[model samples]
Target: MEKIKRIEPFHLRKDREYEPFLQFILKILKEIDPIFHFENTVVSEDRIDKPYVSLKTIKKIGTTNQGIEIIIEELYEQVAYDIAIERIIVRPYGLNVDLKIEIESTRDTTDQPYLELRLIGDEIVNNYILKLFTQQFQQIPLDNEKLKRELLILNTMIKRRQWYTVETRAKAILDNFPEHPQALLALAIARAAQGDLEKGEFYLSKVLEYQPENCDALYNLGVIYEQRAEYQKAMRLLQKSLVLKPKNHVVLWKLGQVKEAIGEIRDALNAYQEAMKTTPNPESKIFTSTDFRKEAKEAIQRLMK
Candidate 1:
């Protein structure tokens, strides 16, 4: 038997159009199999346009009359408002398949959400099931119970500053629904805060997989790289994120830090000045009177000397 490696979920950046794409995929997957349980489901804003659910799961067939339990590992990169489904399926005992499903929804606007379903191998039947599952899911209303439970766990971890526990809980959620973008993001943040920059990068990468234009994920990635002394990579990612949210003070501040680390004193000073310009009044409290600011000012003054 070939070793089964766990597949990672798609990265949906905070500022990308991921939800509509996710929804389109979920609708199709639901149509494929309603009984298939998904884990690590994440929902968040995608490009300020719509909310999307990113999900992942291990699919299994109940013991049949022949007593054979068929298990298939699958992953999806999709959106909520979009009707496109891009999936990869691996069945050890059978032919492996990769498919893209495109569906056009006539019930809405002329730019109907098109669904893209692909069959890479013998998984065409499974694709059909995805179509059926989507139909059924549409009839059901949104259920926030699962989300509430996950959020509660996250809140507890945050309040206690149990960063490790937060990551563990988030991972457990992903174990069941690996495509959950919010869980991925939260886990990334928790990991970074816990000083596990590598793991955080892994999670942040997942966010980028789905939402290429996610400014938050990019910024976070830049921070992680900067911490690791990967100055050039950090600069590139931070610059990209800044392009999307030019007024983001946090990004500016971090860019300053990266520049300072790389000995670009002038650039660093400019970045800090820019950060101060856009920083909100309430937020300024966090950095205004601290030793950190004192050190920063002293460093800038020394740069002049």
Candidate 2:
């Protein structure tokens, strides 16, 4: 039996939007079959009518004495295809969004895993990466504690690419988790995204002070320097990060850029090719978002000619 690890009963508020102070960590629980089912659950052993996502499972979000209607979609190669929820099921289970996941084993090879992430109580539901619930309403939120929900919402906003909202949420997170590395990184990225590299640099530098060799922080800082045309500084940092995360696609891509900028076409081409060869962790969902993967391929093609 699937035990309730945690339960922040769902609440419904239409037209409810996101807040900037929230952050989220997408986690995968169990893997199921790829033939999508709503009322059916996909579990380890085949059972009667087990769907990965369904109205029964989704109704939990609206179980707070209300009903909700939302749409779920499959994103194929940057194109989003929608799955409409014609009506809200008022049953005890929950759903109504595009948060889905698929079995990742090579034996179950599908073109891509149509994963959806949803934040359920403290023990996140291993679902819904699309959005996080907020508590602007009177009812108890997806999580009883407002702060946790805020973090979830913030992460969702970041995934959605809402920069202004991310900056606001990042500030909120920093105010509370003062030394939280990820929160600091989020804020720095938010600032850099909005064209304020100096502020971004300051926050990232702070992160490095706490965990000096953090590859993500190091890589991001290096990118910031690259943006500022400080090639030597950027090169030094990127090289340091590569030492830690030798196969990191983003790091290798940045190295390609830095080398190209320094008039080292041959070295740049080699770096891009190396980037193309790196394999990312499928569960982290970083591969899809790493545009440099495609860029690296294109760059190699261009350079070879």
Q: Of the candidates shown, which would achieve the greatest lDDT relative to the real structure?
A: 1
Candidate 1 ranges with C-alpha deviation above 4 Å:
1-142, 152-160, 280-299
1-305 per-residue lDDT for model 2 (tens digits): 11111111112211112111111111222122232223322222211322333222221222233222222221222222222121111211232332332211110112111112233332234322222312221233232376677666766776677765565555555555688776787777777766679988999999999999887788888989999899999999999989987878878899999999999999899899998888563433212355577889888898888
**lDDT for model 1, on a 0 to 1 scale?**
0.54
Residue by residue across 67-130, what tens digits does model 1's lDDT show? 1111111222243234223232322111113333332211111111222323332355554545
Task: Assess candidate 2 and give its TM-score to the true structure.
Answer: 0.51
In candidate 1 the C-alpha lDDT for residue 159 amounts to 49
Give all candidate RMSDs, comma-separated.
Answer: 16.7, 16.3
- For model 2, the superposed segments whose C-alpha errors exceed 4 Å read 1-152, 283-288
